[model samples]
Target: MPNINILTVDDSVSMRLLLRAALTKEGHQINEAEDGVAAAEWLEHHQPDLVITDINMPRMDGFGLIEHIRAQPRFRDMPILVLTTESTAEKKARARAAGATGWIVKPFDPDQLNSVIRRVAH
Candidate 1:
């Protein structure tokens, strides 16, 4: 797998740690944010190959963050993946509408997550 830069956003510290360990082990550069608000701040100064975000967060949610990213012309085509516990069709449709590139349910497998990053970042 290519060494891609990725932003992993989640409210849970454990989730962020897990993602960092998994991605770093695959030689991918990983940046982390505890919530959507922090992720937004991070995005201000950095551009990553992909963004993986959780749906439920303080200040902003994944859907809201997707809208924010899509609204900006420079980030309009940036790949965004929603990694959340919710798997409802309605939520998926909403995320797609908000410009999410893909959706992955929470408790994600490391290999599957890396595979998705490869596919989307390509």
Candidate 2:
């Protein structure tokens, strides 16, 4: 797959670092934000091929971010993947309703994550 730009939103510094390392290894450029608020601010100036976000976060959660992104015409079609430890059906449904393109449980497998990224981002 061709290299793509990706924005990852999560509160954990280690999670962001892990994602950056894994995605960067696949030749994808990774940008990170500590929370949805930061991600939204970043989105104001930059557009990435895909976005991976955790569901629960301080100062605007993933759902809010997804809704915010969808409200903008420019980012309506951007692929958004929810990556969180929550795997409840309710949460997944809510995320889908919020305009998430897909969901992946936390402690994700790098290969599977990259595969999903390729499928949705391409």
Candidate 3:
């Protein structure tokens, strides 16, 4: 597997910690942000191999972040996995339309998270 750098954006500190731990255990270097705005700021200085963001966040939501990333030429093709408590079909549809590479419903399982990352991080 390649050495992966992942940026995880979520408002919940515990969620971010959990994701960081899981990803780190899988040998990924993880960068964390409390919200989409912070994630965007971090992206300005660093480009991670992948982005994993929560759909619900203060300042900017996952869809907004996806739009922001897509608007940037440098990050246009960056893979993004949206994590959300929302499992509605409409929500998933919106996510796909926003250019998210995949979706992970909240309270994600560590093994499943790793699997998704490995599958999407190419």
Candidate 4:
């Protein structure tokens, strides 16, 4: 698979580190953000091939970030995957409505995560 640039947003430092390690091993460049607010700031200057984010965060949540990204013409079609511990159908629907391309629960499998990234980003 071709290397892709990814912006990963999560409040948990450990989760961010784990994602960084896993994605880096798959040859994807990753930019980390502590929350949706930080991710939005980063998005102002950079464009990534895909975005993976956790829903529950301070300042701004994943839904807000997704809406923000979609509001921008340049990022409207960018693949956004929600990675959160919340697994309710209502939450998933809300995420989809907010323009998330896919959803993955937390404690994600590295192989599966990479596979999903490939499927959506490419």
Candidate 5:
């Protein structure tokens, strides 16, 4: 697969680190953000191939970020994957409604994550 640039957002420092290590190992460029607010700032200056964000974050939850990104014409079709612990059908439906391209529950496997990124990164 070609090199993919990924922006990963999560409130946990540990989770971000893990994702960084894993995705970097897969040869993808990763930009880490502690929350939606930080991710939004990064998004304004840089456009990644995909966004992997977690819900229930402070400052601006994943849902808010998805809506914000979707509102901007430039990012309307960008692929966004909700990488959170919430697995309820309701949450999934809401994420889809907000323009998420896919969903991956937390505690994600490194291989699966990389595979999913490849699939959605296009």
Candidate 6:
């Protein structure tokens, strides 16, 4: 697999650590953000190969973050994977509508998580 840079945005500290450990071990560099606002700020300063974010967060949610990224010409085609505990069909649809490339429910298998990252990362 290519050594891609990844930005993981989640309000939960545990979730971020889980991702960092899992993804970094798979040879991807990880950047973390506590919320959508922080994610956006990180994006402004760094361009990553892929972004994995949580749907439920303070300040701004995943959908809002997607919209913000999509509205920007530079990030319009960027790949985003929603990695959250939300498994509702409606919420998944909303994420798709907001320009998410895919969804991965939390407590995900380590291999499965890596697969999702590989599929979306350029």
lDDT tens per residue, model 6, 37-122: 99999889788888899999999999999998888888877899999888999999999999999998878888998987777777
Provide TM-scores for the models.
0.96, 0.98, 0.96, 0.98, 0.96, 0.96
| Full-model lDDT, candidate 4 | 0.95
Each prediction's whole-model lDDT (CA): 0.90, 0.94, 0.90, 0.95, 0.92, 0.90
Q: After superposition, which runs of candidate 1 have C-alpha atoms over 4 Å from their true positions?
A: none
Clash count per candidate: 0, 0, 0, 0, 0, 0
Model 4 Cα RMSD, 1 decimal: 0.6
Q: How accurate is candidate 2 locally (lDDT)?
A: 0.94
Off by over 4 Å in 5: none
Best by lDDT: 4
Candidate 5 lDDT, 4-120, residue by residue in tens: 889999999999999999899989999999999999999999988899999999999999999999998989768999999999999999999999999999789999988888887
Judging by lDDT, tell me the better candidate of 3 and 4: 4
Per-model C-alpha RMSD: 0.9, 0.7, 0.8, 0.6, 0.8, 0.9
Q: Candidate 1 on 1-122: residue-level lDDT in tens? A: 67988999999999999889889989998999888889989998888888999999989988888898888888877899999999999999999999999999988999998888888786
lDDT of the structure predicted as candidate 6: 0.90
Report the candidate with higher lDDT, 2 versus 5.
2
Worst 10 contiguous positions by lDDT, candidate 2:
113-122
Better of 1 and 2 by lDDT: 2
Which residue runs of candidate 2 sit more than 4 Å off their true CA positions? none
Q: In candidate 5, what residue range of length 10 has the lowest lDDT sum? A: 113-122
Candidate 4 regions with alpha-carbon error over 4 angstroms: none
Clashing pairs in 1: none
